[model samples]
Target chain A: MDASLLTIQPASPEPIYRQIVEQLRRLIAGGQLGAGDLLPSVRDVAAFHAINPMTVSRAYGMAESEGLLERLRGKGMAVAATVRPTQTQTQRLALLEPQLQALVRHARELELPADAVLRRLGRLLED
Target chain B: MNAMLKDAADRPGPPLAARDLGHGYEGATVLRGIDLDIAAGSVLGLIGRNGAGKSTLLRALLGLLEPTTGETRVFGKPALAMDDGIRQRIAYVPQQPEALAWLTVAQMFDYLGRFYPRWNHAFARDTLARWQLPANKLFGKLSPGERQRVELVRALASEPELLVLDEPAAALDPVARRELLREIALRACEAGITVVFSTHIVSDLERVASDIAFLHQGRLLLHCPVDDTKERYARLWLPARLGPHAPASTLGRRSHADGSVSVVIERDAHGRWPDEAAQPGVRLDVLGLEDLFVEIAE
Candidate 1:
């Protein structure tokens, strides 16, 4: 996995640690981070993001608790070999839910028809 | 005093704390009623405008300066009379760290390392090499930024439980600043080092600080988690006529000649803005630390 895939928005209201957790979840579910792929050390991410290492540790801890990551002694964190097979499809698509919600909300706010919004999404997927 | 010591032994508290700490110079008050409790394993960023008493507060906390009122305690012992064991556990990097100009960097390290029980010479050597600081050069020959890095190396090598830094980044360039922050984070994460660093660079604070304390007019105007501060305080733009209806908690305000007003107000603890901010003409914008500082300082 590209360590650079993890990024943070300092201005956003979301806590830094949650951002790390959410982004790592997306990368893992999206297949960008495959099973057993090594996640960057907390020190590296915290240094790159200029955030508290505790925040990065918290994110890693949350992912570990959720079974998305596994800790290997002396090897740092890695994507778990298996994560939620029962909800595999749901979990993969769930990664896009927030962006989709925002798109739908924006379309509704602009008074666009639901069909029109769906058509645009279809076109986007095709692209 | 014996009773207090026994009580401290019974129930250990925060690594550092101060209660109603106040100090003055020549009868003119500089710090007043300052209160702080530094949690173990957390990074706290202290920020304020020039001469806002940040230095004084740090000095008082370290027991370097006697408070005219109230008191400061380190590991529950009176700060002023901290035993050598307690003193050894704490390290300080002053705003303008001074060194013996005649001594080579290696000699200086050797001198300081003698005093620290847990000093790691290898760590100090590695950091110097990483920063590309010349160990052979006399301390006086190094630039201000290099000097600062040396101080950092010395401080970090000690493995102190509590590290106090006053404007540690003032002399650092951007790259060096980032390196310093990374070292601080690594220490806090691995060793649970308790850090209290004051800086004018809000961006650095935004990055590493778990919590931020804003000193204004000789008092702590705000102290809270960085995330909470970001979520709760915002700048709102509205027509000048609506200014009177601004939230009662408006921290600062500025009137534009265009008949619009910009006001900084904090949302309630529930993270809800005042109804006035939700009115049709009001436009609320999230503020980064720098913007927030400007608004609050003004």
Candidate 2:
């Protein structure tokens, strides 16, 4: 993956690591990345982003711990198998619904019709 | 050996792992056999006197310096082989903001924005405005504080997963320092970005760091959580008594028996002290990171 593909939002009260994790998770779920795909090494990520390897390492470690990715002994990290739909997933996805709904509500407030919204959503999904 | 390996295998892997990390100048060794692990999403403050290899360690971690001996991995990936895609997720701010001196503030942004596909233009603009950095001014023309702000903007703009800062606030004024620290703290708390910052100033570490790794003589003398250090260490004031013989159960060495003897205790939980001194004037004071640094350095 090119470093240019990653966007960072400093204003969002989110810590940099969580932002990276969330973005990677979204990318994986969206199929931009897949199982067996190798991620960048921590130092490379840090230098490219001009942050600390420790922070990137933390995010990777969290992802690994959560089973989002698997670590090979000498090979780099790879996306884990598709996440199972456990009770936790249902509850977590439920919690995220409100945020997604708010985004849709904002789109509606902007006077965007359902077709426009759907089109944009489809485009985002395609991306 | 197998049992020891099994025991080691049973433990969790380090948050940050470096293998046989070595660096040097000419023939002298600056860092050697350095192996370190910081827990996930925790703050680790690196401290050492001048020329004690703190900066070198940071550079090595960033792959800025080619190590002489071993390798480093963030999480578990080899740092040396980090791909550009992976690099997008990490952030590093050096101690000195000299890398982009030729570009104006605006140009610097424009240049860096090209590298990160996800660069947030609005956030960068807003931060520039907040810092009052003149977009037209060349980076070299900015004052130290202003330059530091530029570095801050660049680092934060990336929304990095890991933040490695080398004395990031060294040039900032007190208020700016506090503001930056608060901002960093907020990021760490909300986003879980792991932070490893190096500083000679103890107060800075005390204000934001949860864990500290003391580097003395190119070696890590102690690495522990901040709370552990505070709760376990105490300053002991012993009155000269007990027939001039000092108690042997102290963490620090006995002071010369002047009128009053003072020692630092590493493990003191109870509020009371044994009444064996001549004047019975024993008092305990909690030692902060600064005090701890002074004692350890001594």
Candidate 3:
């Protein structure tokens, strides 16, 4: 992916490292960054965004710990070749925590029952 | 100091260090009792209000000015007794560069390049072209922003092991500021250059600084890694009823008309808030870098 695809908000209360990690995780989950896609080097990202390289390194380190990324010898970082096989199904689902939270909140505010919301979700998934 | 910590003799010294460094002029102390050791290859951002002695501190650190008391060590030698060999390894750009103003930008660079052993002529030429600066124009004739950029180019062209700037972005437009920040990040990441720059712009510091030194009234109030800022200090609020129990001393404190008290507090070595935070009606807030500076500097 191009460095321009990674957006950074310097004014946000959230730490920059967390911002990068969240964006990369979402992109990976959405298949925008497919398996084996080579990630940009830390120096390039730092230079492009004018941010500390250590901050970028820290985010990459967290992703590696989460099994979402792997480092290749002499090739820098890349998306893990396979889905994070070690993470349990429930753990993988946890990546959608924000969307699930919004869905639940809106369903509750709309006075929709949990069963109805699940059925709607099922229908959407089938479609 | 840890058992694993190397002996002073065995360890390589940081590029910059000060011990009990103090300075004053005309019977007014601008800075005092500063002890700082900048980690090698780390970018240190100095911040303070106007006339808070940031310039004075940097001058003393760079051996350009003698402090009233204490001493500084640059490259393992006394700051005041620096030799040309050591001086050539460091580059400093002042808030306003007045030297060689009559010379054309090209001529000025030519002279400086001769003196700086490791000057990068191609980098200087390329940046001037990219920024559209007229190298043929007299240095004094350029706009303040343009002059500042020329000074920046001069500094970076030296490829100094240590780079220091006083408010390098003060005169630049947003685009120029971002470009300067990008250049700093690129150098630090690729060349492992140690950099110290004083700036009031917090966003710029957030982008490129690995460490921050908040100078207040000539004293270093805070010196820590950028990432540690949010977790290190907090603002504690106490409603009027609970205000009486608030800590007597804090980094900064204020009492509202309604008797509510707001005080800036810090986590202890163990990362635990003070006991009072657990009291009923007390609220703790993690402060952003700007907010933390405001809370203390105000």
Candidate 4:
């Protein structure tokens, strides 16, 4: 996998390692990363992102525990040979739950009507 | 087996420790009541603004300067009286690395290598080649960044169990800095070398430091794991109309001309953000290391 594909927001509320885990999950679910694919070494990801290697290791470990990744003998980590099922449509859509909540919260904060906010979201999705 | 690694497992306490460390120069205190501990396999990033006593604290920890009050220890022995056996396992790169002007890089390395029984010449040679440092160049003729790299190579070649770096990357370009961070991470993760490095560059600290220490005005303000810091500290933006009602968690506050106020706050022990911050008209935001430094140290 291209380590560059994974980036973390330092200022985000979520911890850095958790961000890595979530991004990797999305990639795996989307088939961007396939079974037996070599995941970037902890050092590569850490050096590229300027994050602690231990943080990268923790993310990889979490993914391993969840069956998304597996460690190979003397070869570091790789995508699991047998992947779990791809996320269902609802499950995939659920990935946007936090973002949708933010949109609603901001719309409320701005005192925009539901119809207007939905119109804006509709236009954005069309784009 | 290397002497440094032979009995490391038998050691009892933290690799490095300082108790209520204080230092004064010409009646002015540069560090006060600073207590810090570095474990065997962790990295601690020491961060403070200029004149915030970062260099002083590092020097005190290395026993290069005797603190006016308190004490420091390496390998369970008082730093000031550390014997050669303990000293051999520790390496320090000072903020300004001084080298003799006449010697070339190879000469300098050769001279220094004579002092350490475990110095790895091949590793030093390979690192110098990788870093693109010219071995035949006069030590003093090299640029500041080159000199810093040379100092780091020297420090790493000895394979020290505990490494102390003071602003080691301040002179390097971004690429060099990244390479240095990678090497530090590799050593700490693979060899269990303990590292304590001080840097003004907050992003560098975010990269490889397991824990971070914030020093302000000669005091050690905060020292904790980096992730816990994110969990415990936050920033809240409130509409100006609400007026400035100071909450118990407020650490610092700033008001903008645009009718909003931003306040730094600490989360309660139960991991709860400030009560008011969760209410309408207030937005709670997480802070990165740079912002945290500004909030707590400014």
Chain B only, TM-score of each candidate: 0.90, 0.81, 0.93, 0.92
Report every candidate's CA lDDT. 0.82, 0.70, 0.85, 0.83
Report the TM-score of the second chain of model 3 against its true counterpart: 0.93
lDDT of 4 at B187: 80
Q: How well does candidate 3 match the true structure, expressed as C-alpha RMSD?
A: 6.1
Calculate DockQ per candidate and list them: 0.34, 0.01, 0.30, 0.42
Top of the candidates by DockQ: 4
Number of backbone clashes in candidate 2: 22
Candidate number that wins on DockQ, 3 or 4: 4
Please report the candidate that would top lDDT against the real structure. 3
- What's the CA error at residue B193 for candidate 3, in Å? 0.3
Q: DockQ of candidate 3?
A: 0.30
Q: Could you tell me which 10 consecutive residues in candidate 4 chain A have the lowest summed lDDT? A: A103-112
In model 1, what are the clashing residue pairs, if there are any?
none
Candidates 1 and 2, the one with greater TM-score: 1
The DockQ of predicted model 4 stands at 0.42
Please state the CAPRI-style docking class of candidate 2.
incorrect
Residues B3-108, model 2: lDDT tens digits:
4244335534443678778888899999988888776667788998888899899988877778988888865567777677657757787766787788998998
Q: What is the per-residue lDDT of model 1 for residues A14-67, given as tens digits with 9 covering 90 to 100?
A: 567778888878776666777888889887887677679877888899999988
lDDT tens per residue, model 3, B157-216: 998878999999887778878998998888887777789999999888877899999999
* Model 4 root mean square deviation, Cα atoms: 3.1
TM-score of 2: 0.60
